[model samples]
Target chain A: MPAVIADGLVKSFGDTEALRGVSFEIERASVLCVLGPNGAGKTTAVRILTTLLRPDAGRAVVDGIDVVADPRGARARIGLTGQYAAVDERLTGFENLQLVGRLFHMRTAQARSRARELLERFSLTDAGDRAVKGYSGGMRRRLDIAMSLIADPSVLFLDEPTTGLDPRSRLQMWDVIDGLVADGTTLLLTTQYLDEAERLADDIVVIDNGSVIARGTATQLKSASGGDRVEVTVSDRDDVDRVPVVLAGSLQAGVEPVLDHAARQATLPMSSTDHVVPRVVRSLDEAGIDVVDVVVRRPTLDDVFLQLTGHRAENDTDADDDDSTSAAVPEGAAR
Target chain B: MTATATPTRSGPVPSDRHVVPTGATWLARDTWTEATRHLTATRRNPELLVFATIQPIMFVVLFVYVFGGAIQIPGFASYEQFVVPGIFAQTIVFGSAFTGIGIAEDMSKGFIDRLRSLPMYPSAVLLGRTFSDLLRNIFTFFIMLIVGLFVGFRLEGGLVDAALATLLLLAFAYAFSWIQALIGLSVKSVETANSAGFMWMFPLTFISSAFVDPSTMPGWLQPVAEHNPFTIVTNATRALYNGYDPGMDVVWSLVWAAGITVVFAALSFRKFTSNSK
Candidate 1:
C-alpha cells in the first residue's frame, strides 16, 4: 500500500477556496514534493495531510490510518515541520526536543537519550543547552525538524522546509533531508523552488491556483514541455537584431528566437540541439555578426512551469541561472 | 556537518500509536508536559518573573498609601484592611491577561500548529497555559501579601480562613485565564492581544468594590458594582481577611469560579480545535 494518500481533498476558508480536489500518493520510503507558488494552496494541502486541518470534503490516509477518522492514530505515525520553525524561542534546544519526546509519552531517561542523539545528528550538540532565541535561523530550523523526528515517525512532512534560508544554509538543509530519505523513511515535502523539487523529489506534483497542473518525474516534465535550446550572445548590442534572422536563414526554417536586447542574447527553442550549434555559428560567421558565445542547453523545470502555467513559477530567483544558459547539474547519489 | 551519520530510523521505534495513553491519564501527562515547558521558560527569563512581581507590588504600595486614607469602606476601620484584599484580587485577575498574550505569541510563532499536529491531548495547551499562569499568580500573590504586611496591613482571620481566601482568589483568576485564552486565540497579533486582554479588565476591577466600597460610588453605578462578580470575590476575601463572616458571598464566589471555568474552558477548547489559523 502507498504510505501516504490524499484523495479529492477540498478545503475552503469562507469565500476563498484554498484547495479544490487536490490529490496525490506517496509510495513507501520515497519522497514526493508538492510544488507550487505562494497562495497556491501548498500549505493548505500540507496542513490537511498532517491532520492539523480537517478537509471539508475528502480523505487523507497516512500509513493506512484515515487522517480525518482517526487523527491521533495518524499523528502517531507522522511528524510535521511547518514553514516557520516552531521551536519555543525561550527554551533550550535540548529542552525543546526533550519536551516533544515527553509529550509522545517516552520515558524520561529515554527522552533524554533520544534528545541527545537527535541534537548530535542535526549537528546541534554544542548549542543544545543554550536558549534557541540566540541561535541562528538555520540552527532553529534544524532543531525544529529534530523535534518532529523525536519519535522516529514512519512518515515525515516538511512544509516549505527551506523557503527563507541563505543559499549556503539551503544547501545544508538539502543534505540533511537527503540523509533522512537514505534511512528508508517515507517523506512528503512541499516546496516552491523548482530546483528543490528536482533535487529531492522522486516524483513531483506541480500545483497552481489550488489545482494540480502537472505531475511526473523532473525529466518527464521537462521533456513534455519541450526539448533542448540554443542560446547565442553577441559582442555588440546592435548585433542582437540580425542574429535571429541569420539563425532562421541557416537552420532553413522560420525560427524566431526570444531576444534580450539589453544583454545582446537570443534564445531559440529547438527540437534537437544535435549539429544545430555549428550550423548557427557558421551562419553567424558568414553574416559577419560578432559572436560572443553560443551553446546548447537542456530545458529546465522553469521552462516546464512557464509552458504549463503561462507564467514563471513564483520568483524562480535561485533558478535564474538554470533558465539563462546553465549546464545540467551532475546527479548525486545522496538524494 | 557530516550527512553520513546513519539516520536514527535504523533502530527500533521507541513509541507509537498503541503507547499513547487515553482519557484522564493522557490529559494529565500532556498538561504537565506543557506546563513544565512554560514554567521552565519562565524560570530562564528572570526578567519576566521579576516584572510579574513588580506590578502587584507597585499596585499594593500605590493603593495602600496613596489612596488608603482618602477612601473609606462602611464596615472597615482602615482602608489598609479593606484595600489589601482587593489589591490581591485585582493583581491576580490582572495576571491572568498574560495567558492570552502568551497564547497569541504562540499562535503567531506557529508553535500552536506544532502542538496541534502532535498526538497529545487537545486541551492540554490551554490547560498548561492557564496552569502555569496560575502558579505565577500564586507566587505574585505571596509577594503582594508580604508587601501588604510591610505597609501595616494585618490579617485578623484564622490561618484556615486566610488559606481559603487565597484559594478562592487563585480559582477566580484561573477561570479568567480561560477567557484570556479565548481572546488570545481570537486576536491576530500579540500587540492586539496585549491591549484586548486587559482592555475590559481595568473597568471590571475598578467598577466593582476592589479599591473602595460600592456605596461610595456614584448612585448610577452602585448597582453594577454591587452585583459584579469581581465584587463578590473581593467581598468574600476581604471579609475572611478581616475576620468577618463571609456569608453567601463565599458560596457565590465559588459558584462563579466553577461556572466560569466550566463554560470558558469548553469554549476555549472548541476555539482552539477549530481555529484554522
Candidate 2:
C-alpha cells in the first residue's frame, strides 16, 4: 500500500469549500510536497491527513490505516508540525521534549534519555534547561519539530513548517527534513516556497482554488508547460519584432520583448536553445543586424507555478488575505 | 500468517523498541510532562503563586474577622467557626476561573495547536491543565486552612472528616475547571475569558451561603441558597468541620460534581476538537 493516500477529499466550513475533491498519493520513504497559495486548501489537506480534521467527503489512509475510521491508529503513526510553532513557552526545551516522551508512554529513564538525545540532535542541548519563552523564534521552531518526533511516527506531516524562519534557519530545517527522509520516513509537506518544493519533493502537487491544478515531479511540471527559456538581445529595438516572424513555430504573442531605447536593443523569447538560437542568429546576421547577447535558461519553479496556476507566485499576496479573512470571519457571515 | 526467519543483531542490542515509545503510553508520558511543566511555571512566577494562595486567605480573614462581628448566626457559637468551611468551598470554586484563563493564554500563544499535532491523546491537554489546577487548588485550600486555624477557627471533625471535606472541595473544583475550559476555548481573547469567568463566578459565589447562614436570608432567597451546589458543598464542609454527620449532602455534592464534570468535559472536548481543525 502507498504510505499515504488521500482520495477525492472534500471539506467545507459552512459556505466556503476549503478542499474540493483533492486527491494524491505518496510512496513510502519518499517526500511529497503539496504546493499552493495560502487559501488553496494545503493546510486543510494536511489537517485531514493528520487526523486533526475529518473530511466532509472522501477518505485518507496513512500507513494503511484509515484516518477517519481509525484516527487513533493513524495518529499513532503520524508526526505533525503545524504552520505555527506550538511549543509551550513556559516549559524548558528539555521539559517539552520530555513531556512528549512521557506522553508516548516511555519509562521515566527512557523518556529522559530520549529527551537528551533529541535536544542534542536539534542543537538545543546548551539551551535545554532554559525556558522556551526566552528562546529565539528559530530555536522554538526547532524544538516544536523535535517534540513531534518523540514518538518516532512513521509518517510526518509538516504544514508550512518554515513559514516564518530566517534564511539560515529555513535551510537548517530543510537539512533536518532531508535526514528524516533518508531514514525511510514518508513525509507529506505543504509549503508556499517553490524552491523548497523543487529541491525536496520527489513528487509535487499544486493546488489552486481548492482543487488540484497540477501534479508531477519538478522537471515534468516545468517541461509540460514550456521546454526552455531562450532570451535574445538585439542591437536595434525595431528589429526584435521581426525576429519572432523569422523564427517559425515561435508564437509572437507568447514572446515578451523588452526594448532598451537608449541603446537601441530589444530582447525576445525563443523556442529551443539549439535550433532557435542558431536560426535567429543566422537570420539576424544575414539581415546585417548585430546581436548584443543571447542565452537559454531552464524554467524555474516560479515559471512552473505561473504556467500551471496562471499567476506568479510572488505576486499572489491576495492568497494570504484570503486565508486570514476565511479564518477570522464567522462561517455564517461568509455567505 | 507464517513465521519468518529473523535477522540477528550485528553489534550492540537494539534499544529502539524500548527507547521509542508509541500508542497510549506516549500520550500518558506527554500529559505528565505538560502537567509538571505547568506546575513549574506556576512556581517560577511567584507572583501568581502568591496571589493564588493569598486571595483566598484574605477572603477567609476578611469574612471571618471584619464581617464576622456584623453577621449573626442562630446556632453557631462564633462567626469564624460557621464561615471558615464555607470560605474554603467558596474560595476554591472561585479559584476555578484560573483554569479557563490559563487555557485562554495557551490558545492565544498558539501552544495548544502544537500540543494537538503531537501523537498524544486529545484528552490529555484538558486533563493536564485540570490536574495542575487541582494541585494548585489543594495548596490554596491548605493555606486557607492554616490561616483559619490561626484566626480561631477549628475543625471539630477528626482527620478523616477533614480529608473527606478536602477531597470533596477538590472534586468540585475539578468539575468547575472543565466549565472554565469550555469558556476558554470558546472565547475570542484571554482578557475576555478573565472578565467572563469573573462575571459568572461573582454571582455564583454571592448567591450561595458562603458568608452567612442560609436561615438568616429572606424567605424567598432561602430555597435558592439551600439548593445551590456551592451551598450544598459549603453545608457539608461546615458539618464535617463541626464533627457533625454530613448525611445526604455528601451524596448530592458528589453527584453534582461528577455530573457537571462529565457534561462540561464533553462540551470542552467537542469545542477543542472542532477548533483544532
Model 1 Cα lDDT, one tens digit per residue, B1-277? 3321122342232333334557787788899999999999999998888877888889889988899878877778888998999999998998999999999999999999999888888789889999999999999999999999999888899788999999999999999999999899989999999999999999999999888778878999999999999999999999899999999999999999999999999889889988753
**Model 2 interface CAPRI class:** acceptable
What's the i-RMS for candidate 1 in angstroms? 5.0
Q: What is the number of backbone collisions in each predicted candidate, taken in the order shown?
A: 0, 10
Report how far off residue B27 is in candidate 1 (Å). Answer: 1.4
Runs in model 2 deviating more than 4 A are A223-306, A311-335, B1-34, B107-119, B214-223, B244-247, B270-277
Worst 10 residues of 2 chain A by lDDT: A326-335
Question: How would you encode candidate 1's per-residue C-alpha lDDT over A1-335 as one tens digit per residue?
Answer: 99999999899999999989999999999999998877889999999988888899888999899988888888877899999999999999999999988777676667888899999999999999999999998999899999999888878999999878877788899999999999887898998766788889999998887899999997787667665667788999998888877766433233235688777888776656668878888889999998889877655545666779877655444544444433332221112
Clashes by residue pair, model 1: none
DockQ in order:
0.43, 0.29
Best by lDDT: 1
Off by over 4 Å in 1: A227-231, A248-256, A270-286, A292-302, A314-335, B1-19
**What is the C-alpha local distance difference test score of each model?**
0.85, 0.77
